[model samples]
Target: MTTIDKAPTVQSQRAGTGTRGTRILGTLTIVSMVWLIAFGLGFSPADRDQQEAVRIMYVHVPTIWIAYLAFVVTAVASGFYLFKKSLGWDRLAGASAEVGTVFVALTLIVGALWGRLTWGVFWQWDARLTTTALLFVTYVGYLAVRRLGGTHEQRARRSAVIGLLAVLLIPLVHWSVRLWRSLHQEATVLDPDGDIDMDGLMLFSLFVGVIAFTLFYVWLMLHRTRVMAMEDMMEDRGLDEALASRRREAAMPDSEEN
Candidate 1:
């Protein structure tokens, strides 16, 4: 009797997608988050006008900043995927969009909570809020387009186009307050005159939030892209095995009747 030896599968060879660099980044993110919470919720002084409601800025501002950054990355990666026809770029774009969508949703939720406290309303059709909602919906659609039934290249091509077009809304959302009348205040940190209209401690805490969220975003991207790569590998392997099985069955000889 002959014995067959089976090779190890991709999953069997690896435990997870994490790496040393990602582990370090994850650690840094956790530390920064702890610091941000301490300062944002405990140390930072309340606004004379907005009072305790201003504390929400730490989370609200950082979330939108990360969301914008993620969307911009998705657009850039999508362009590269279109030009180079590389699956790596496509995976990056998809992962970025997914992360951006989560941040945008968080931004909306936090913004609404802040609004309820400051404006005594949970929602309004203000320019900034409306445009932001549009931005969120647009990226959600982009993510959906990525999952449409088709070949990988086909999906990537369509998604890349949407990713590029969707990012154009970001500028409009950011400047919506200046572009039209709105209940939302103009930029306090990113003022056009390069002046920051925030208390020193509040500003510091906001910056800390930005750094922490950015690190978290990088960590998520690293793991998400690796998972995407593994999924692609498994899919290709399955197809190849199926084809080989069909070929072996076709090559078998028929038995003769007695």
Candidate 2:
């Protein structure tokens, strides 16, 4: 009797950036967000001055905080990339910058809504607003610099420089209210005098917002960095294939002449 050859089973890989850790993190993020919504909207009492409009602070504050954190991470990672000449650090810097840009936009939008309610105008020439807008624009330019065409090293070097320089705006933006006579309120949670201006429950809700957003940031960074890595791999592979194709074509002309 003739034995038939057995076909080997090929394991199929799942597509997408998620992993077991990210899934667990995503679950935690979702749960924390639900709690944040409950505490921020339902449980926390309205501000005596701003009334229901104070609810926006729960989102507005955390978003700006995360944006600042993301920029700092980008600056640190960019520094490491410059020192170590490592692509991993470069990928991290790019991912963080992208995520930070989104958070900055969110912060501006939420702040505008809060401003409209409290300051009686959606837009203002306040120092805090101007500096925040400048911060957002600077990062947007940093991202554009990253996309400028060149080798990976070229892209990383230029972008890293911009990343390092762009973070200088954060301190200026943070202190703009203090440094100038402005309509923007001083920091309540991070009061310079160490006095907590918010109620107990309100403070707790703000903390919850911070925690939820931080978790979300980690989850997003995980997915984004993985995606960036995959993109680089694809780009390198395509370049190699194109070079091989060129070699084959160059040899074909000689073979045809022969």
Candidate 3:
């Protein structure tokens, strides 16, 4: 396992940070989530074409947005770890990737629901859908690699490299609709021509959903990182105890006489 001399310090610092900020963010995220649900489910007018199905967009789009953000953060952290060889960066990268996997999985589920409703099919091999699925699987593989048995540095280095390489798929996923004739629509709010093709209320609801999910990701990352740090500390203590026992045995006199 990768060892950090300051694992205890890192854990304590994160606990302190999580105390005040997590509470505030958690509360605010709940508030935003409530408003988003109300706006998406009741206030926002249904789409002329898809009607009730369009509401899924509020959930589906924001989740993918947050998932993308999570992967980007992971990649950046991994890059820093490579450059500075900081265990903290490696832990952050791993934590972010795990959270990103959850969000991306949710993204795929919600997207499938939306597709079934809007397109009369649960899935399609379109450019955007395929690339998004690929992105999800890639990060999932990254997480799996992190769990493999190895020294902390070995696992961290391998996972960090995978994390950075996986981000290359992000652009492909984002621009897949444009790059090919995908059933998925190209950017609506982020249209290159600076046009939003949705109602004002719907747009606001989408924004709230984005903020809520983003805050949720932040909370998840903080909690998950703390958990990883504690695990690392436990692993370190186990190794120390085992080594001490070995040293004690070596110091003991041989009992064989005769």
lDDT against the true structure, each candidate? 0.80, 0.81, 0.78
> Per-candidate TM vs. native?
0.81, 0.80, 0.79
Q: Which stretches of candidate 2 lie over 4 Å from their true place?
A: 1-12, 168-196, 239-258
**Model 1: ten consecutive residues of lowest lDDT:** 1-10
Give lDDT for model 2: 0.81
lDDT of 3 by residue, 1-258 (tens): 232222346325444325566688889889888988899899999887778878888888888888878888899999999999977888989988888888889988988887787667787766667787888888889989999978889988999998887777567666864566545554432211122576899888888888888888887777677678778766868788789878887787584342
* Clash pairs detected, candidate 3: 1-151, 1-152, 2-152
Candidate 3 wrong stretches, greater than 4 Å: 1-18, 169-196, 239-258
Which stretches in model 1 have alpha-carbon errors above 4 Å? 1-12, 168-196, 241-258
> Candidate 1 residues 1-258, lDDT tens each?
001111235547656777677799999999999999999999999887778878888888888999989988899999998899987788889999999999999999988888888777788666667777888888989999999967778888999998888767667666864466545554432211122576788889989999999999999988888777777666768888789878887787563332
For model 2, give the 10-residue run with minimal summed lDDT. 1-10
Worst 10 residues of 3 by lDDT: 186-195
Per-residue lDDT value at 34 in model 2 = 100
Higher-lDDT candidate among 2 and 3?
A: 2
